[model samples]
Target: MKKNILGLLIVSLLLVFVAVNLLTGNEAAPASSLEIQQAESKVEEETVKVNTEVNAEIPYAKDFTLSNLQGEEVSLSDYKGQIVILNFWATWCPPCKEEMPHMQSFYEKQDDIEIVAVNLTSMDVGLEKVKQFVDDYGLTFPVLLDEEDIVGQQYGIITIPTTYIIDQEGRVFQEIVGAVDEQMLEEMINALKSYDE
Candidate 1:
């Protein structure tokens, strides 16, 4: 009698497991080609904001001229009619290092947007390190040296890898604080394009 009861319990558990799998099988199934393509093309609307308190009251980015690695003066106003990704970073920062590749990839694919990376020289190692980093990463975007942290202060950069998305009209559209991948950059630019339209 004990053996029979044990057998019945085992069969009941197997039945329950099979029932659950049958109910959830569709979710586990592989997506179709069209479904995969749609998923890849569609950008999901989600919250990507960081340091909201700092950017809440700020409407437009303050124009400032900073010398690039090549010692050429580049100003925020120079990119007024274009979307700008203004990033503040330091040489020793891990996240900043991680983000540079993605930034470079996105910059290469884009023709209308501009990426201005501001190296916080005062907080970073030095000018030589910054140059080495740019060369090692093969970055073509304009890298400005904030030797005195003046631009960093103007942009309210308390953390490394702080990126601000400026609209075509020089409005501060979004402020992302952290490492962002190429997909995230593409989504943000696509959203900005929609907003511009």
Candidate 2:
């Protein structure tokens, strides 16, 4: 009788162990899968939001002339027949850094679109830092230094990464307050091109 009791106890323990392992293992698998699905959903939602924002119209674009990094004078008037994107940024601003690569890529892709990345002068961020940033990011767009903050003040810039898209007729087509994505920049360029036609 004692032997039978021992056998039953061993079987009961084994069954309990199996049940626990299966329950925990099954629960973990679903949780991991759910987490991955949630992450993918979040990414999709963010992409949609960015696309919607890009498609929206811009307000209050303007024109300005400034000197490039090579100390040569450049004028928005010179590009009168082309779409221009004037971006005001500072080297130290995080948002400025985030949007630069996208700007560079847009500049690379578009032939008729002109991008002017104006470095704000009011901030204490030095010229060396700006140069380093331009080099590190491989920015091919014209980088103008606003040494006296003249251009920035003229545009009423209150923050870094303020962008203005100008039409071919020398009028402001859109004004963006912060760092903009490549899609938005492309949309603005397309809009300006349509205006020309």
Candidate 3:
């Protein structure tokens, strides 16, 4: 198989975009803005401190176990042999909300891929709010709870709606830091399929 060059380049550009987005805070919809309302609703801006430092090099996606709404534990290893779209998001993020329909639609149509919408549970308003968000969005994909932010910290998730597409071999195939539409998602998955062939 060819090296995952497309994935690498996308990740590189996304990192640069994220840095610029943070410094300017002028983007129409920065990924950080996804949960901004929740932040404002709870903490005053004066009390909010932004962490400028992040792990410059994100390691390979690590295996983690998180609970779903059904209270069952799900792990990355369990999805072995299938492609996984591991997404980190929160209920209060607008961009995350913007992207979920596309993700859910793709999940419903795709037979060979698994979509795991990992909710930043620690940052959400409450469990009831997450349930409401899921019900409102009509999402059928497995929604994992990162209640302690452990997986987010491990993945160096500085932004909401951060997505890592893991290939069937359990390798990180691609990473997108912002919202993605259906066409883009389909193209990426198709490219991965072609690579495997």
Candidate 4:
């Protein structure tokens, strides 16, 4: 009789414990889709913040004044409020030859951007050769002459056709080491505009 009473007491305690848990709603539940999306969005925003920090290291483009093909002085600061494509190229570089037409096409199509094509004249044969190349390609963009290689040294142009994408705020957005086509230039401009927005 005493054993039966102990078993009944244990059963009753277990039942009470379950009833309390059910009443308080202390049960595990799955997360909703909306909560998951919010968490993912937060992670994406944090990733963008980290990328922006990395870009801050190469903050601004270096300013320099050089003479264009017209023998007029042109400074990088002249296009401060515009998107500047600071292209470093030489006359003998095959890749430079490859991109001049595309650069010209992009320049004519887009009025909102500036192409500051700096010819590495010091490395090339002469100013006459640079002029002839520009004429042959019909590149109407401002072709600045790096006659003394001052700007080349400043920009660290170890490779031919090194293009720096400078934003409207004079920040170096990107550096394209080789040749770039018209489509690439368009996409880069659009991306920079979107980033600014």
The estimated TM-scores of all candidates read 0.72, 0.67, 0.70, 0.72
Candidate 3 stretches greater than 4 Å from native: 1-60
Task: State, as a TM-score between 0 and 1, how close model 1 is to the true structure.
Answer: 0.72
Model 1 regions more than 4 Å off = 1-45, 48-58
Local accuracy of candidate 1 as per-residue lDDT tens digits, 4-106:
9999999999999889888987457788999987776663332432322233444988999999987889898999999999999988999999999999999
lDDT of candidate 2 over 11-88, digit per residue (tens): 999999989988888555445888899999899667544533323344434456777878899876778877788889
The alpha-carbon lDDT assigned to residue 40 of candidate 4 equals: 96
Residue 185 C-alpha lDDT in model 1:
85
Give the better candidate number (1 or 3) by lDDT: 1
Candidate 3 per-residue lDDT over residues 1-197, each given as its tens digit: 24598888889999999999889886675547648877785563232222111233434569999999999999988998999999999998999999999998999998999999999999889999999999999999999999999999999899988998788878786788889778778877876677667
Clash counts for the predictions, in order: 0, 2, 1, 0
**Per-residue CA lDDT of candidate 4, range 1-197, in tens?**
99999999999999999999999999878879998999898996674444333264557999999998878999999999999999999999999989999999989988789999999899999988898998899888899999999999998899999998898889998888888888777877777788788
**Top model by lDDT, which number?**
4
Deviation of model 4 at 175, angstroms: 0.4
lDDT of each: 0.86, 0.79, 0.84, 0.87
In angstroms, how far off is 50's CA in candidate 1?
A: 10
